[model samples]
Every structure is written in C-alpha cells, then in structure tokens.
Target chain A: MRERSDDTLETPITSMIDIVFLLIIFFVVTAQVDKDVVDESITLAQAKNAPAIDAVDPRSVTINLNKDGKINVALQPMSISQLQQLLLAMRTQAGSAIPVLIRCDYETQFRHIDRVMQAAASTGLYRVRLIAEATGG
Target chain B: MRRKPPEQLNVPMSSMIDIVFLLLIYFIVTAREEVTEAHLAVNLPAPGVAKASENKPQMMEIEVHPGYLSVRGMRLPIQEIANTLVRLGKNDPDITVLVKVNLSARAEDLVTALDLCSAANLNNLNVVTLK
Candidate 1:
C-alpha cells in the first residue's frame, strides 16, 4: 500500500517541463524587447481623439521633453542644437520621411515644444507625432 | 512492509523544474507595466517654402492661453472650443485651423486644443508659436 502511494506521489516532470518551456516561449515573444523604451518620468497629456498607434516604427526617433525645458533622447539629455544635429543625421540616413515622435510632459510649456518642432523642421522632417496617454487622466 | 527502493543515479529534474517555475513567476510579476500611449500626427511647415494651394481656404485663428483659449479674438473656455470648431467645420470643410500657442501655455493645453480640432474632423491644422 505504501509503495502504491509513493508511486502516485511522483510528479510528471516531463510534461511540467514541456508546459514551462512553452510558457517561456510565449512570454519571450510577447515581451518584444526590441520595442522603443518608454521613459517613466514623463507624464503625457491625455487626449480622447488621438489615434492609437498599433505598431510604432522602429526607425522613428523618440524625443522626450520634460517640464523644465530639458530634452531626452534615448534617456540621455541633449540640447536643442544637439537634437537638430541628431535629427539631420537621421534624415541623411533614413531620408526626409523618417518619423519623429515627441513625448512631451503634460506640464511642459509650448515654447519648449516649439524648439523641438523647429529642430525637426530644420532637418526636413515635416510630419511628426506627438504622443499622449491612451486613456483619460 | 515494502522493501526500501534502490537509489538510482539520475539528474534532479524535479527540483530544477521547481526553480524554473519560481523564476518564471517572478519575471511575470516584476515585469514593467507599460502604459499604452496614443499619438496625434502633426504637419510642420517646411522652412523657406510657401503653400502652393491655388485657392487659399478660409483660416480660423485660435490662440491657446494659460487656462482658456481664444477663437478668432473671442475668448472661450476649453470645453466650449470643440463645439465652436464643429460649427465652423460644418460651415466650410476646407477651413484651415491655425493654432497659435502662447509661450506661457502648457503643453496639455495645446494637446487639448489639437484633440478638439481632431474631434471636429478639422484635418487642415497648422500650429505655430505665438509671437
């Protein structure tokens, strides 16, 4: 009787490992580590009419503008002229149609955003995207 | 009484699987919670180039202030701006909405203005810094 109970207590290791491996694969694919890194410090504006971006362009440059008139590109703070030079280099590499996404803080002033816009315009990037929160604040 | 089972030499798969499951759960819980974000597409006027449209459309100038917005010299609250745009858009589909953002205006105010324009289906939008 004890032997039968011990046999039943043995865990099905092979099947458990199989399920674990499958779950790992699912997570790995869904995580999408290649997607653009979002800055946690920026508080984006909430807009109801804004269109949802299903898939962000991998080549697009994300510019984060904080409330203090500071600009962050890839988590590194940069000046307006530096931003312009970076944008120009990107345009030269990816052509004028290269996308630009501006992630401006909700409390930031318009003048700071204007500077970023001017920089993009100088680089021949006509159309740019302004990011907003998906839901109401 | 059952005889003691002979010890078999093999890898400890059960404990390893237990550790793997723990790690997976930890990752699933500690992963960054990404806040879904949307975007509003804007067109910036290229420098040194004039608009080539043969027939210029009627333009509505809207100024964004600190807490309110002024539409064509008439000051209006943020909530009422959408209705005004809708009424104007219905009158003329080709009307261009020119947004002059004040230096003191918050970015949220500009976004609210643009959102209202979009809600009114006013596609021809031009935003410039108010001098």
Candidate 2:
C-alpha cells in the first residue's frame, strides 16, 4: 500500500489569501470615497424618523453648512452664488435629477440650510436630502 | 529511508493569513456605508414653476421658534409639535406641510419639526425661509 504524502494534507490557501486581499482593497476604496465628499468638521443633526438611503446616487452633491452659515462642498468653502453655479453645472451634466445632500451642524441656524435648499431649488435640482444622525444624537 | 520534508514549505502563510483577516475585519467595521446618516428627502418647487393642479391643497404651516414651535400662530413645545402634525396628517396625508424656520432658530429645531412631519407620514412637505 502506498503511504499518503504529507504535502497532500496541506490546504490550498493561496486562493483564500488572494480573495482576502481583494476584499480588503474593495473596503479600503469604498471607505475613502466618503471622506472627500463629506466634511468631518460639521456635526449633523439628530432625527428619529428619517429614512436611511441604501444607495446614494453617484452624481449626488453633498453640501456642508456650518453653524456660521458658511457653505462647503467637497471641503471647499464657497458662496451661495458659487454653489448655484456648481449646481447649475451639475444640472447641465446630470440633467436635473441630481440629488443634493445637506449636512449641517446641530446649532446651525435654519437660515443657512434654507439658503442651501433655495440655491438647489433655483438651479432646478429639487431633490434635496437633509442628513441627520440616525441614533438620535 | 525516510523522505525529508521539502525546504520550500519553510515559509508558512498561516500567520500572514491571520494578520490579513484582522485587517479585513478592521476595514469591514470602519467602512462608512453612510448608513449611520439618515436622510429626509424634500422635493422643492422649481423656481418660476406653478403647480399644475387646479385645486389648491390645504397647507399646514409650522413655524420653528427659538424655544418652541408654532402651528397657525399657536405656540407648542418641540415635543408637542409631533402630536399636532400627526393629527393633521391623519386628516390628510397629502396636506402640504410648510416648515417656516426662523432664521435664528437652531437647525436642530427644524430637523425635529421635519422628523415629526416624516413620522406622521406627511409626504407633501415644503420648507420655506421666513422673511
């Protein structure tokens, strides 16, 4: 009778390591995309009933409104007109279905958010989303 | 004669695989899928555009004050606003809810009002800035 070789007992792990590396790379890439569009400095409001968006449109614009009513898009601070222009440009490219996500500090006055919404409305991009903390924080 | 183990098997990948799995778990936990952030969707009226419907819907306006919320000039606390909105929504789910947010009112106040509106399943919501 032929003896079983020890080499045959070793599991083929090379493919598993490859798969793990791919998964890690995928997660790393997706985790990073939000950093550029979402400003970490702004503290979002807390809400109990807002629906969670499962898939955010790629063409969606994220606007950060600070307590002082300043507007930041992609981390670059801009005036309301500048925001209008950006929305117009996006509207031209994305054809008016462009979703606008607003992230504002809890203490930020409503006027700031209103201005952002008005800017979006004027640009014919009326799909506005107000971002809030889901945990009621 | 006993066969010797191959020298090529000296570098075991089990330890490396363990570290890779740890990294994968870290990334999985840290990945911000934006699920932590809830969203309230609003469809704003396009500028210079009028509603096509001939019938004007009954609009319920809620003003966000610094300390409390107001419905049709009646003052109510933030916690109590939800009950009023829920009652209105019960009457008509399509009732237009106009949130008139005071310029000095904190964003949290407006959010709370909208939260209540959403909770009531009020679909027609319009946010207008107070003059």
Candidate 3:
C-alpha cells in the first residue's frame, strides 16, 4: 500500500499567479480598443491600397450616406442645412482646422455629395477628405 | 559552512511584479482600438507612377443607371459613350470625369462605364453614388 505524505502536497499559488500574468498579457496584446463611430449599415468600398488613416484624432467627423440617398451623421438622419450646421459647430469645437471625412454609398449622387463638400468649404473647413478604396492589392 | 539544495532557493518575485506592472502600464498606454470609418466598396486598380498635379474642375460626367448610361443626364449609346470619352480625353488631358452610378445599377453597366473611361486613358476619375 502506498502512503500519502502531507509534506509532498504543494499549493499551486505560484503557477496560478503565472497563469494570471499570461492571461493579462494575452488580453493586452489581442484587445481591439478602436471602434468605428458609424454603424455597419453603411457599406464602404474596399480599396486594397487605401492609405492608412489615423483614428485617434478626435477632429475627424464621419458622415454616412445611405442607399436611399439619405444623409446621416452617426446614424442620425439630417438635412443638408442641419448637416452644415452640425459641421460648423464641430469646426468651431475643433478650433478652425477640422478634418471632415465623408463616407458615401456607391449609389449616392454627385450633386448631393458636392453640396456637402460645398457646405464644408463654405464653413472654412480646409481639410476635406473624400474617402475612397485604393485599387489593386 | 553547509550548502543548501538548489530546489530550495526562493525566486525574487518583487522584480517580476515590477515587470508585470510595467507591462500593464505599457499596454494601457498603447492599447487604443483602431477606428474604422465609413467608405465606398469598390476595387481600385493600382495606379502607375505619374506626376501629381493640382486637382481641377470636373468636365465630363457619366451617369450609370440599371439599363441606361448617360453623359451629364443626356442619354447616349454605348458606342458613343466610349467615343465621347476619347474625344474629351484628347481635348484636356487633365480633364476630371465624374462617374455617378445608381445603387441598383448592374455591375456590368458600371464596368462598361469604367471600361470606356479606361479606353480613353482618363486617370482623374471621381466616382460618386446617386442616393
């Protein structure tokens, strides 16, 4: 018969601590902290060579154009005038050099987008970017 | 002096704790999530090396709907579309072509319009969707 010895029993505290540290490192490395302001209902064109954009800057504003030709800012529908007003307010908040990013659907009209651009230009917003997919991966 | 066994030696956990804390801080500082912005869904071809120039006003506009193709709202035939693009390209090498296609427009229709633009060697093409 084999005799069990209490002296041989060892608490796995050190191993448990090591496992906790590993978990922390794993989460730290794999966590996705950046999330898009706009919803996925808006399908953006895929460009294999699109320039890498900086998302940490709070000065960038995203405007979405739906398939129905409706304009929405962060999922809230707004008129051109309203959009202009909101953009102007954002410009003021961002202190003069605000970057406006417009993401429109593939079926949106030029005139509609042009009007939005015109509004941004008139508001004295200089950094206007028309987002497009870079071709040919 | 008597020597102790190697397995009985204690590891200095303080240093390891400091490392863990430093790692935690480093992750906290650099762990910002990537923000994805809205965009159009299209495959753009790789652009060859060309001299950059100031953007100019758009001269030619091509509209693509489900069954018809129009140039500046004027309905035109497929053969004429390519011809017009070639003529316009010859007139102004810096010409800006605005391509507006409806959402429900067929992929073939969009491709045909793009093909016409390609045949004309028009590089400054701006594609917009008709909402």
Candidate 4:
C-alpha cells in the first residue's frame, strides 16, 4: 500500500486580497447615493409622453410629501403660510424668480397639494412645476 | 542571503494593468456625473392621453376642487375661467396651462374645466394630481 503525502497546501492570500479591494473601490465610486436620498416611497404618476428635463438648476426649492399628507421642505415639516413666507424671502434674496418644485408621495391627498399650489400662487410665484417618475409605457 | 529565481519573483504586469483598467472603466461608467435637479413635491394625476407638445411655456395653473374650480385661488365659473385664460394667453403667446384636479372631484367638472381651457386656445395643457 502506498502512503499519501500530508502536505497542507494553502491558497495564495494576496490575489484574493487585491480582488476584494477592487470591489470595494468599485462600489464606493459607482453607487448612486444621491438619487436614493430622494425618497423612493413616492410612486410618481406615469406620463405617456413626458419630456425629459435635464440640467435643473440648484436654485429651485423642493417640497416633499409623505403618505400621511404632511409637507416638508428638506425634511422639515412646514405649513402653507410658512412655505409662502420662505418662498417670498427666497425670491427677494435671489433677485430672480426662483422656480418651485413639489415632490409629493403617490398616496398624498389632492387637497394637500392644492393648498400648497394656492399658497405659491398667492405669493406671486407662478413658475410652479411638479415632479414625477418617468414610465416606460 | 540567496536571492529567489527570476521566474519565481516575476508578477504579471499585463494582467494587473488590465484589471486596473477594467476597474477604472466600471467606476467611470457607473458614477453619476450630473447633479440631479430637485422638482416640485406633488403627486400628479395620470393623463389618459399623451402629453401635449412643449411648444409653449406654462403660464397658469388651474386647480379643481369638489365644488368649485379655482385659478390661482379665486373661484370662477367654467365660462369665466375660459375668458380669463384666453385673456392671459393673448397677453403671453408662450403660455403653458396646468390643470390639477382633485381625486374626489367629479369627472364632469374636470372635463368642463379642460374644455374651457381648450376653447380658449390653450393647447399646452397638462393635467396633474394634487399630492
């Protein structure tokens, strides 16, 4: 009977280490963290033929709505009156008409959005825009 | 100390370069280079028809409620709304009109308001839902 050799051969560790490092770098650089920050709970309505709006300036203000029908600016809850005042102040400071964008959740009530629109209108901010996700169909 | 043989010490530079290039390309392709602009936080209503052409700029927003239709907050009748929008369009040829309807608002009321806008020659109309 022939005896088998008992050499315990181990795999080279540096190559595995290098591959793991590359993967970490790839995710760190490529992951889209900003888009994820924009709340995904809101399922924007589909437009059969909505034009793509690219290169939106940062001067625009964003309002976020939750399912419970609450309005928040940059994640802070605000009343219609407060939003109106804030917009007015922004207009004054910017010296140019600042565009207003509303980001409401799909489950939000219609009246809640109406109030916000009314508030913008009363404040003389007429350049109001609504944001929705694009649909394939 | 005795040095190791050249073959044993050799590391494949070409393979390492290829891997590095692949990693660079992957990151460059996946990164979000452009800053995403923030939009209005409203859940718009889905439209039955295709969106109108973007030949004109949106100038007015008409909101429909259960009992009344308001243009910029002032309650007005369907005919009055048409007249008002026509006047506004005449003043600004590049006028875009947005009609936001409440979910509970009657379909007839919404259709009437839309008809008024269309009759006024406001072709650039968009229907949206309130958040």
Candidate 5:
C-alpha cells in the first residue's frame, strides 16, 4: 500500500490571511470620517431628549446655520433664496422620502432655522432633524 | 534500505493567522456603523396632515429678541423661560407655542427658550420664519 503524505493533514492559511487583509483594507477605507459643518467657535444648544440618529437615511441633506443666520452647504455660504432653490431641487430629485438634518449653531436665532424649515416645508421636505448637543443628566 | 524518517515541517502561518484574527476582532469591536450626531427629528405641519377643523390647536406666541424673550407680552430673561413655560403648559396642556424671533437674535437664545417648551412637555410648537 502507498504511504500517505505528511502534508495531507495540514490546513492552508493563505486564503484566510488574504481575506483578513482585504477586510482590514475595506474598513480602513470606509472609516474616513468627514468633518462636520458646525464651526468650532460656535457652541451647541443643550437638549434633554436629543439623540444620535438611528438608521441614518441614505437620502438626507445636512444644512449648517451659523449665528449670523447664514446657511452653509459644503462650506459655501448661501442666501435664503438660494437655500430654498437648493431644497426645492433636492426635493424634486430625491422625492419626499428624504429626511433633512439641520445643524444650526446654538447661538443662531430660531428664525434662521425656522426660515430653513419653512423653506424645506414649502418644498415638501417635511421630515426634518434639528441637531443639538445632549444636555447633562 | 529503510526509508529515511520523515522530517518535521514547521507551520509558518500559524502565528501570523493568530495575529490577523486578533486584529480582526479588535476592528470588529471598535468599529461603529453610525457616528454619534445628536439631533431632534420632527415632521413639519404638512397640508395633508393638518385637517380642517373648527377646534384649532390653542396657540401661544413667544417672540425671541436680542436681549430678552417675550411670552404673551411679558419680556423676561432667558433663564426664566423654563419656569414660565412649565406654568403655562400646566395651565393649558394643549397650548402650542409659536416662536417669532428677530433676525439678529442668536440661535442659542432661541434653542434655550425652545428647550423650555420641551421641558414643559409641550410637543406642538412653531418657530416662525423671519421672511
């Protein structure tokens, strides 16, 4: 009878090692976090019930409102009319299912945020999220 | 002649595989799918959502100014907001606070006032637009 080779019992690790390396690369690529639009000088208002978003909707627009009531998108300051136009465009492009996240500075007047909300509402963007800092327990 | 005794082969990948698995576990434990971005989600008063009714919601007006917050014509400091709202909310649970702020007022002041309404458990609110 032919003798069995010693290598017959050994399991190969090359495939699993390659898979793990690929997984590490995938995570590293996806973990690059973009800086949020809120300015460092501005303080965030406290809220008792504010919570981190749950199951972030893929179709979401984040607009930043500074203390000056200026709305900034991707670091470019925009007028209220411009913002309205943008919201109207987004609403038409993505449909009403998209949720809008407004990150207004804590010191920003409510009117600015309200104007944005009104614009969003006018464009049929009713679903909204107002970003704020969590208050102390 | 008797065949030479088989030589012992060292497994080169055992330790490397163990290290890779440890790293995999570490990444799996540390990775978060969603970042912690705090927010308050609300649905605006949609035309379809608001039905025509004679019994409209009781509305309360609160004007946000640069130096003070005016609730029902009484101007007060920002700190006095919660107490007043709690009292008003107690008087009428269904009171909807409508906030009208000057363009110059800071967002912090507005939110601080709004926080009062939230503290008083007043869910129906409208932060009126400037324009």
Candidate 6:
C-alpha cells in the first residue's frame, strides 16, 4: 500500500477569484450593451446570421413593436404619429448621427416596421438596424 | 516529543464561494438570454440616394401574408424561396427584389423572406407597401 503525502492541497483561491472576476466582467459588459435591444414582453424576430449587438450604433433609439403592430417607445405604447413626432424631435436635437434600432416581434407585420422606417427617413436618419433572433446549431 | 500545534482556522470560503457561484450562474443565464438577439442590418436608402435606374433592372416580387409566401404573384413555400432567389440572382446580380408584406402579417413572415433573400446573397431588396 502507498502512503499518502502530508502536504495540504490549497484550493487555488487566487486563480479561482481571477477566473470569477473575468466571467463577471464579461457578463457585465455584454449585459450593458444588450439592454437597449431586448424586451421580454415582445417576441424578437429570428433570422439566420443576425448581426450581433456591437454591429449597431450603441447610441441609437430603440423602438419595440408588438405582434399586433403596436409601437412601443421607451417602454410605453404610443401611436405611430406620436412616435414619429418624438423621433423627429430626437433627430433634430441629435441630428443624423442618432441611428434608430427597431425591435419587433417575429410575428409582427413588415408594415409595422416599414412605417417606422419611413418615419426615420423622413427625419433624415437613414441608419436603421432591425433586431432578430439568430439561428444556428 | 513533537508538540501538536493548535489547528488554525480561517473564514470559510465555502459560503462565499456558494454565493459567488450562484451569482455567476445567474449572470450566465441572463447573458445567454440577452445575447439571443440576432440583428439584421437593413440600410434603408438615405433620403435622395435612391435614383431612377436608366436600365430597367431585373425585378422579382415577393408577398407575405402570415402562413404563406407569394413570389411573382404565385404562392411558394418559404423553404424554397431562398433557392429560387439564389437562382434568380445568378441570372442577374443587379436584380431588385421588391418584398410586399401584409401589414397585418407576422414579423417572422417578413424575416423569413428577408433571411432567404440574404442567404441567396441578394442585397438589392426592399420592403414596399402597396396602399
């Protein structure tokens, strides 16, 4: 029978802490940027090879459209007219640099998004990114 | 005779580790959920950027109405839409695909069409409204 050595095994707390911090930092960074695009109340559109969040202008307006084609801006439901007015105001205040991010339910009609796009273009803000669920194995 | 040293104890890391692991799990789950967003970058033509084409570019039309897709006024299965678009794009890379979507149709319907268009490498696509 082999005798066991008496040396105590340390749990490598330093390395564990280092790994923990790295993971937390990664999650924190991702969480920060994704907040603008996701909403539990609205189902996201799913597409193959949808661009990642970073592909979007970080300082962009996020508009959520429910399945019924209802527009949601800044967590509140509003008519498309009101939404347009608000976006126009924002565009004027911020200029063409402020891009718009449209997050609509996958089941939502394209006209819902089309209207929003028309509104953005009318305001001279041409950059628009649509959010969808990416698919791959 | 060797003296038996008193057993030294320190703050238990087990409890702290348990809490941290819990938090780590929470963050991981939330992160996965947040990262599910697959964005489609549709660069709508800037105001005044769309000019009239002197050459009547090849045109293809697609319609969306909830459970079905209509191509060139004929209904086609969604799965085959990409293949058809790809074949069409081969004939003319300058082909323009005009997507007419039902205003009340599902967003998935539009996305499915868009995704297939993209998969076929067709960049000249537009979502139009026939009001």
- Winning candidate number (lDDT): 1
Q: What is the TM-score (0 to 1) of candidate 5?
A: 0.66
If chain B of candidate 4 is superposed on the true chain B, what is its TM-score?
0.52
The lDDT per prediction is 0.81, 0.79, 0.62, 0.61, 0.68, 0.71
Better of 2 and 5 by lDDT: 2
The prediction achieving the highest TM-score against the true structure is 1
Off by over 4 Å in 1: A1-36, B1-17, B48-55, B91-94
> TM-score of predicted model 2?
0.76
Q: Which ranges in model 3 have alpha carbons more than 4 Å from their true place? A: A1-33, A45-59, A69-82, A90-99, A107-118, A121-137, B1-58, B61-68, B72-91, B96-131
How does model 6 score by TM-score? 0.69
In CAPRI terms, model 1 is classed as acceptable
Which of candidates 1 and 5 is the stronger one according to TM-score? 1
User: Candidate 5 — what's its lDDT?
Assistant: 0.68
lDDT of 3 by residue, B38-79 (tens): 222222112331112113354677898877899778899988
Reference-based lDDT, residue A67, model 4: 52
Of 1 and 6, the candidate ranking higher by lDDT: 1
lDDT of 2 at A52: 60
Local accuracy of candidate 1 as per-residue lDDT tens digits, A1-137:
87788776766656777798789778776765443456678899988876666798889999999999899898888999999999999999999888899999999998899999989998889788888877642
* Candidates 1 and 6, the one with greater TM-score: 1
- Residue-wise C-alpha lDDT for candidate 2, range B1-131, written one tens digit per residue: 34446665454567886887898788688765553877887666665443532146687778887757898788877667788778988998988777777888998887888888888989777777666
True contacts kept of each: 0.84, 0.84, 0.04, 0.12, 0.68, 0.74
Which regions of candidate 4 are displaced past 4 Å?
A: A1-33, B1-131
Give candidate 3's error at residue A25 in angstroms: 7.8
Name the weakest run of 10 consecutive residues (lDDT summed) in model 5 chain B.
B1-10
Candidate 6 Cα misplacement greater than 4 A, ranges: A1-37, A49-54, A93-98, B1-9, B12-34, B43-55, B91-94
Note the clash tally of each candidate.
0, 0, 20, 14, 8, 6
